[model samples]
Target: KTTDILVQAQICAALNRHVIDVTTPNVGLQDWSNSAEYYQQSPCNHYAKFWDQQGISVDQLAYGFPYDDVFEYSSSVHTPSPSRVVVSFGPYTDGGGNDNDEDITGMGGNLSVQFTDSPAGEGFANLIDNDAATKYLTFNSSAWVQFQANNAYSLSSYSITSANDAPQRDPLNWNLQGSNDGVNWTALDVRSGVDFPSRQQKQTFQVAANSAFTYFRFNLTNNSGSILQLAEIELFGEGSSSGFSQTIQAENYSSMSGVQLENGAGAEADQNVGYIDTNDWMAFNSINIPNSGNYTVSYRVASEGSGGELSLDVNGGANVLGYRTVPGTGGWYNWTTVSHTIYIEAGTYNFGIFAQTGGWNLDSWTISLASGASAQSAATAFNSENSMLEIAEISLSPNPAKSQLQIDFTAEHANLTLLNAHGRLMESTSNVPSGSLLSISHLKKGLYFLQVEIDGKVTVKHFIKE
Candidate 1:
């Protein structure tokens, strides 16, 4: 019986599991397994048994099976950037393989995955295992998978890979939502009529979101068939933008006009404000614009008609921020993001989104500090040196310092913060003195931004670490 089982394993490996008609080669590697009498490792570690080869070194032999590297027992090089690589197909010297390297996917940070529904064998964990050969499938079409991380990630994009079989089971529509409490969710991106044309094919879409969330939920609402299968899901990009960034759901308004809420598709709120017409508007109170100059307001909107336009204003059009033309997205739920960067003053006001042309559905809106507009330059912030409420005159010698950076300010005490280009805080010091020297030797060679907060005012400036 053992001999017959070995032959069956060998046949399964030789066929590659997909060939309909094939000719078996005369000579091939043999597959073997041992019973408890001979093997001591658990069943989970049995894959490592084949490589043992009765103490015969596999370091100089080809892999006997596809998964021979189950326990880092095969020839694989993992590096962020290899100085040089030399590969020889015939004979090569073993450089002593290093298997302790961390997985490349872990750079995005570790995530604990959970799902609302899936089969026993086909688990949600497979969706992020980085193995395209495995997949997550479910009979329930309306399934949602949530990924929680230790820190919030300002995800810029995410990808989905179709399973190896059953193209009809691919998801047709979904939403990528984010939350801090895992209960009060915010729709980050929404997609409808999604199609996976090829098997095991990956499709990446940009996340129209600015705020960061520790919890992300991939809510699959619709599919072609009654089932859904996905081989993998990969999230890309991290860190939120510097300065103020706020996203408000359109349905969560203080007041509205000429619109009604209805169930929508994708990673947005369950309800969207639709039936908009010219002169219709929604207002949000206490919308704070912190040190704002030129703020970019992005609207998540969709329309099936030809023309749709909206205007952002403060206090019932007392001050119009700007207008954006919403493009027809083929369906009312086929959401897309549109933006308008307009100058805004630093104050808390009742913000309003008024329909200028109408015929569109509003899912959500985000207002973020525009790049290079986080705050007035350090020089401008210090123009009034006598004002006690403003940051003092600041200066940094050696604009592109190699190891040390000197910060000079006139304030008796001020808070200094260092952030990478992605707005990730690297170091911070409170009540820093004038002419304070900071060590930057540990930071990589790149651009960095420094924020100086004095009294209640904040000033931003950029510097280079070389």
Candidate 2:
């Protein structure tokens, strides 16, 4: 028969007999009597015969045994069923020990119990007794709890209260630590000397894996040992992290109505205008003007003493306009409006008010576009080139002329183009006689650009037709 058939037959024989003699003396005992005798001698002997038949030695059988009971009997002595298993129940004195009887009673699974003396002395026994209502652990002093590394965890909220009626402890403390391994830890934050009775505070900590930390802990550095307190701790920021940009506008002040002012004296003091001391000037943070136009500026100023004079610098176009001084009004709060009209060219300009006088009060300043008839008169007299160009002094005899408009140029020869408001050429003339008068009597009344090209340079003079 094949080895497989022979093994199968042996297995069937053992099963039918309901016992396998693996340790029968290798005297080649094939008889049932010899196998039973070997098994009776010892379980290991039976196991040896049974395995030897399969070409396994006693040691191999011992090593390869699947059942623990079989392996134990093969290597050690066998004990009969005992009446009871020894168990130690607690320090029944304070009712603070584990119940060992539960093991033999089979009421619950394997029970091994011990009693540890209460760290707290005296009547504190009730506090440590493992009863349903009173079982709790208390740390009368500062303590630290360590958590496993590389894992995210949270803390439970805790409270601290003063034990004494009076303030025995002035401050309490707590801190948090994170660690990659159990041994090395990094302190995240610490709070010290906290007044527990007055304020209840809570804190949280988030430890990142990138910080090479895997553990976290809370250390109660100090606390008032009066009442039981706890804190709830939570962990976040496991996978995401978060961060700001600011835009600042350039400082400028150009508008007529939006001028800002700063004064060190009383509210009724006049403002010192013109010069801007970097330390005392009120400046605008930005200049966003819609369009540029001629702006008129005026300010009120006064000095502290009779001889006290405040000088201010008016700046524009890469240069100072002029410095003006305000004479004193002879009293502490005395003030006056010393005003001037400044013709500001069309463009954004930064300006500020500063005082040179030691002790003076300045206040109520008004600046705006020249009003009404003065504006019209000023616009009329302002020359385009004011004698700089060789063009004949342009004169409109009767400026509010009803009919013919006259123009004169001093050049021997010139090119001229009378353009309408939109700069469209309405009339053009070349080789104009020197000091000769040109007339445009046919045009209707409105604004026009009298562009005169003299010696290849263009000078545009704005005028109105009557």
Candidate 3:
């Protein structure tokens, strides 16, 4: 399949796993493999609640993730007559509360935009309507838009999009300011002589926000023309609880010195950072280590040769965290997860991943509070497959298993049976501990079910042999 197709499949799978819909806010999952009859139950649980939001469509099908079209969950509406398509604009409001459509600030949609130093009737609501065609136009050369979140956020980065037309009206100089109180503002990021070559072009800038702030303002100092117009502004940051786990794709760096994205060969991993050289680094801004003590950082990497090492640091090496030596995984496309625990101070940082030695590809990385990380057990990791047979006690890892399938449960003595797609018994075992690795190297690549029975209670889990 093409990258687009694979990405769509991944998005559909992610949405299904999370059970995200209009009513529920993704509480927990009951199954992982099946979502055909998922909506039959009310208040379903979902995954990735931090970023994913319910769609605006009547059916609640939206593209919360990048690849959400695989199972037709995309908000993109198709029609036979493209020329006849018409989009309706909203009934504008004057700087009132806004339901965070994307949860971009991680503030649970409880945010409002306040306009300052701008003439009346500038249509401030259009600034964040997710529509580039509509704009917040003002005759004034300088303007400021303040975003107020319910909780203080350690903002890492922000983006500004140019209006649909009039290049001369684009902003040239701007300052991103943060503040606890709206009166006292401190500049976090400043840019001058900025250019927007294309219309509706979005440029993201990293903010050196060390502390969390309740209010953030975009101070547009100067513009190319007397009439300044802007399409939209977005803020990215972390909220009060930094204990939650955040997984970031290696290719999705805010900035990079020497790195490139290539097609990933691993299961569900479509892209990865490759062609890394020694001293080459990638920067991910606004990584919030809220009152951090011990945090576990895991990286999914692959290398064909040894001597490759990855070092992690914060804020241009102002604080060097640690380094991990990469072991050869036989092939450049082969992948494995490696982790390390490191202590960090309470602050927001620009996390820098440097290549101490070359010859490895990085797919992704995850950071979680070590103190709260253990709460996520295997069962919690892989939520649901069949709700009717859903057993919260048992869980499986690497669902699209290549070789060994890990079964995690606390059952003292459980009988395990593996059956192929046709329900014919293939493998059987007895008396396995909580963390047991079952070898299925001989099994063919296809759909299979693992039936686990403990104390006369039977539970079936669905997995794919990749």
Winning candidate number (TM-score): 3
- Off by more than 4 A, model 3: 1-103, 106-122, 241-466
CA RMSD per model (angstroms): 22.3, 41.5, 21.4
| Cα lDDT, model 1, residue 312 | 86
In candidate 1, stretches whose alpha carbon ends up further than 4 angstroms from where it belongs are 1-117, 240-466
Range of the 10 consecutive residues with the lowest summed lDDT in candidate 3: 92-101
Residue lDDT tens for model 1, 325-444: 788999899899997556655678999999988899999999986544323332333332334344578888687676899988888867665655444344445557888888876554
**Between candidates 1 and 3, the TM-score winner:** 3
Candidate 1: residue 22 lDDT (0-100): 29
lDDT tens digits, residue span 90-152, model 2:
211111112210100100011111122224431222221111122212334454533332122
Q: Per-model C-alpha lDDT, please?
A: 0.64, 0.37, 0.64
Q: lDDT per residue, candidate 3, 1-466, as tens digits?
A: 6877765565456554544544555634333333233333333333322123212232335554455444555557878877776665631111121321123332222223443444564477656554455578777777777776544566766778888788888988987888766789887888999999988777777666367766778878545667788877777765445355789999899999888989876474588899988989999999876443446789998888873888888979776776676878988888889876565655688999999898998999998766432222223223323445544478799775668989887666576656544343344454567688888665544456677766545677877654
TM-score of 3: 0.33
Candidate 2 residues lying further than 4 Å off, grouped into runs, are: 1-293, 307-317, 354-359, 372-466
Ranking, lDDT, top scorer first = 1, 3, 2
Ranking by TM-score: 3, 1, 2
